[model samples]
Target chain A: MRTKTLITSMGLFAMLCVVIFGLGVKGLALDETFRRFVLAALWVCTWFAAVVGLNRAAASDRNKSFFSALMLLPFDPALVYLVRLVSTLVWLVITQALLVLLAVPMLKFDFFSQPLMLAVALMADVGILALGVLLASATGRLRGGEALLTIALLPVTVPVFLAATGATEALHTGSGAAEAWPYVLLLGVCDAMFLALGLLLFGKLNEG
Target chain B: MKAKTSNAPLITLALAALGLIGAEVTLYLSYFYTPVQISAGTLYVVTPSSGSTINLYESYRIFFIHLPAAYATALCCTLAAVGGIAWLLTRKDAWQALIVSASEVGLATGAIVLLTGTFWADYAWGSGRIGSGWNWEPRLTTMLILWLAFAALLVLRRAMDTDKQRAMMTAVYGILLGPLYPLVSKAIEIGQTSHPKSFSDLLSAPEIATTKQVATIGILLALVSMVALRYCWNRLGQRMAQERAA
Candidate 1:
């Protein structure tokens, strides 16, 4: 059932992306600047959806999952949080891949040309997933949690978006790997920080 | 049994009075006593036709309050985060009060920072070719983020029904958000943008820095006073709820 839901969700998300970027915006025969702008808009939208979805996922786990209680019985609450974060990251990766697949055919971008950039984008998503899971879990059960989640999430992820965009832009221009790595490195650092923070605080947040 | 009355309101009233007085004194000193050039940094306005150096003169005086307010905001946020951790460990109302109060104060100060900053920017740059008066300079961006995070903390607090749950959740959020302040500072240093190294660069004279420090002390006292008042209010509310229950 979960798998079916996941597949259906991905299909709808892909269709939505195609509607927005593929056909909605003059069928992607846009100038270089406009194309990149559309790409960025899609990037933000993808992550935003991931955050919203993950928040629901985390909340449902807490309220509905039998394993949640079982998992908490073990001394290591961190393991449960790790599992949730990893699962969220996996879902994000799949959705991101689906988005890119739809985007590539419609937008006509050379994916293989910038393998390094693609890796950075994926890692950046991992960072977003870490943040999304932690924050979403932290606020998910509360009233007005969704709005609060977006408010807290967007500002914190500013650096992530900034770095990721810069790196991706560099890659698209076939700029040397040198220009791109700094941004990627920044993303990596942010991801590390988010992951560490999630591990340390997720249990505390979930307790009450 | 009748609940014992808290002296917090009385103390906060006194502190608030003193804070107001100190603020007035600081304003007087900034205007009359401190050197303009020393108090306000060197201001240069760039123009398309010809680049010109412009001194802000009396207009630069905003920094006296602005700088201290900004500092107080950061300090309050730190205190709130620390108080959050302490609250979690001790499971005490006092710590929760500390977190909630400091967060409120932080939000107020953050607003002041943005407000005064806009006016100061207007004086410095808005008058010139750069009419926008607002720039996404790294520091400004980070400060804006800090403000939003704290605001979110307040929203989170409102969402919870029980004090214990609210305290626990907010404390955790506070700690998680705390690192952003220093991290943003570091990121700004690495990814250079147009914010100055320090707002006090114009304070070349020792006397100016001294006056600024004095103003900071005044602002800090005001912040503490406000925090105390807020906590007392929280306590009173809790007591009222208890009384109703009884």
Candidate 2:
């Protein structure tokens, strides 16, 4: 049953991603305003996915043993969080790649051609996903957790969003990548801060 | 058995009254005594210019109130973060109350900052060059973030079923975002937006620095006194609720 649920959810999530990204590309191709709108949409959806996924795992009887076994391990609890973070990043990267692929044909922007752009997108996704999971886990069991998480996530994500958007726009315009580098660096710093805090705090939150 | 009531609320009220009086005095000094300084053009020009280019904007009187409100908001958030850290380390009820009180006040003051900021932005940058009042300038953007974060913190605390869970989560969230304050300021400095480089820029001349300094100190005291009053009120409310349940 757990395996079935997991597979079904994964399939549904992928289909949803395809539809959203496809429509986004078809409608808003090559428009700077639309690009920003897309970025905002991506952050919201990614955050929702992280929270929903974590809540489901916590709810599942099957995952209980998995979490417990990891908790009882000789290693530090941060390792468990680190593993979860990595797995989430992997899933996020796959969805991002799909979106990029869908946009490439309609928008004529190739993620493969520009490795720096690709790196920025991937890094930004990891940072966002990490922060999302940490916040989701912190608030997931409570009443109105989802709403609270959304509100809390917005303010924290502002710097990351601005930096990521600025860098991507610079790359797309093929102008002033030098100017964009600072934003990219800022993005990296934000990501590191999120990842480090997530590692340190996830265990403490889980304990209670 | 007879119950004894604590005098904290009365003391807090007195402090709050003093703060209100101080704020009014500061406003009077700023408006009546000080000469208003304004940047010639744009809402948030960060560059330093020679004294000749300085323009007098009577509307610039808003700076006195705006700066104090901004400072109060920032200080309250800092207090929240500190209270959160203390709670995490000790798991005490006092720390929880401290955070809750500070956050509530922080949210109110943060709104003041945003509201007054909009007026100042309009006066400085809204007309002439941009025609629009809003800019994604770093300081304004950061304050918006801070306000939202404070609101979220309050929501998160209320959403929890248990006090312990609420306290723990609040502490973590507070500490996690504490770094954001400094990051925002650094981003503004590096990005260089329309905001003036220093509060000193708002002063008319070097001689009036004494007035600015005293007014600032007065406002800071008033803001802190208000936070203390809020903390006392929160504790009083909690006690009343507990007694009713009993």
Candidate 3:
């Protein structure tokens, strides 16, 4: 069932991407920058939907066979979180790269020259996902888990969003990587701190 | 249910009230009576500056609210930690009460700090200069997260039917991770945006001698009054719970 769900979701995501790309090409053919923004927005929404879908799949009792497979598999939960983090990071980076690609034609400057922006975006996403997964795990145990998790996670993720957006904008404006490195490092440090703290406290939460 | 023959409550109340009053007087003197000075194209009129002085209205004036809130939040968190530790050691109801009260007050003060800080940021950084709306300043960010954590602690307590379980969990989290607040704040400070330094620089020489002194006293009094009222409410709550159990 989990495999089915994952496949269905992936298929849906692919379709959504194709539709967005088609729309971008048809309507905004000459406006590459605008196309990039639209594509990035679609990517962000798709990633969020995928996470919610996967979480729902995990919680459903109808997936007993899949649960057994998951249990038998050698993959650790932490590794699962890490992989999810990586996937989300890749999605965001792709969106960013697309934005830069389109911006090059419009802005008359090299948008992708600073590779560190991609690294920074990835770090920020890691911090965000770590915090998100921890809250989701906690809230998922409760009755109104998803709603509670949303409320609990949104405000906490504000800083990460701010850092990510600021650094991204700075990079686009042709700022040196060294200039924006501090914010990226800050995001990385926050990610590690929260991950460690969550792991330490999660055991207690699970018992209850 | 008779009162214990201890002056501890009275003393605490008095000290807290005194602190509040002192802060208030300092605020008055700093703004109303202090001389205004001009510096570098900006008019430096202290809080409650004289009516005639062209007050640049350096948004730092909001520090009157921000500083007290910061101090109160820090105090409450510390109290929560200490109370949690005491409860763990002694398994006493009084310690649990202390933890609950501290957490409540901490949450309230944290909210106030965030609000006032936003106002200050709006004035200093110009509205929407940092990020779109909210800037990822370390102090603001961590204070916010700490507030959420306390909120979670309170909700968890409410959700649990048994007092023993509630107290145990609250104590465990409070004592174990209380230090993380400062640690996280410090790391953010080192890694990210530049905000005011939290330590000694918070109270400058003129600030201490002037309107800040009055504001400090007023805040202390306000906090004392608030805590006293909360304590009374808590006592009533306990009595009702006991009556219901009986």
Chain B TM-score by candidate, in order shown: 0.82, 0.84, 0.76
**Ranked by lDDT, top first:** 1, 2, 3
Best by lDDT: 1
Ranking by TM-score: 2, 1, 3
- Deviation in angstroms for A5 in model 2? 7.8
Question: What's the residue-level lDDT of B45 in candidate 1?
Answer: 22
Cα lDDT tens digits for candidate 1, A87-128: 777777777777777777767645557779677878788777
Model 2 misplaced regions, further than 4 Å: A1-75, B1-5, B36-56, B128-131, B204-208, B237-246
The candidates score, on chain A by TM-score, as follows: 0.88, 0.74, 0.62
The ten-residue window of minimal lDDT in model 3 chain B covers: B46-55
lDDT of 2 by residue, A105-199 (tens): 54453456546877787777777767777776656565556667777777777777777777866776677578789889988998888888888
Fnat of model 2, as a fraction:
0.67
lDDT of 2: 0.69
Model 3 whole-model lDDT (C-alpha atoms): 0.58
Candidate DockQ scores, in order: 0.53, 0.63, 0.14
- Please say which candidate is ahead in lDDT: 1 or 2: 1
lDDT of 2 by residue, B1-246 (tens): 123246776777787787778788888887777754445653322233222333437656677777777888878878887887787788777787788888888888888888887777766655654436766666777888888888888888788777667778888878765866775566556553666667554453643455567657777678778788878777777677779979
Between prediction 2 and prediction 3, which has the larger lDDT?
A: 2
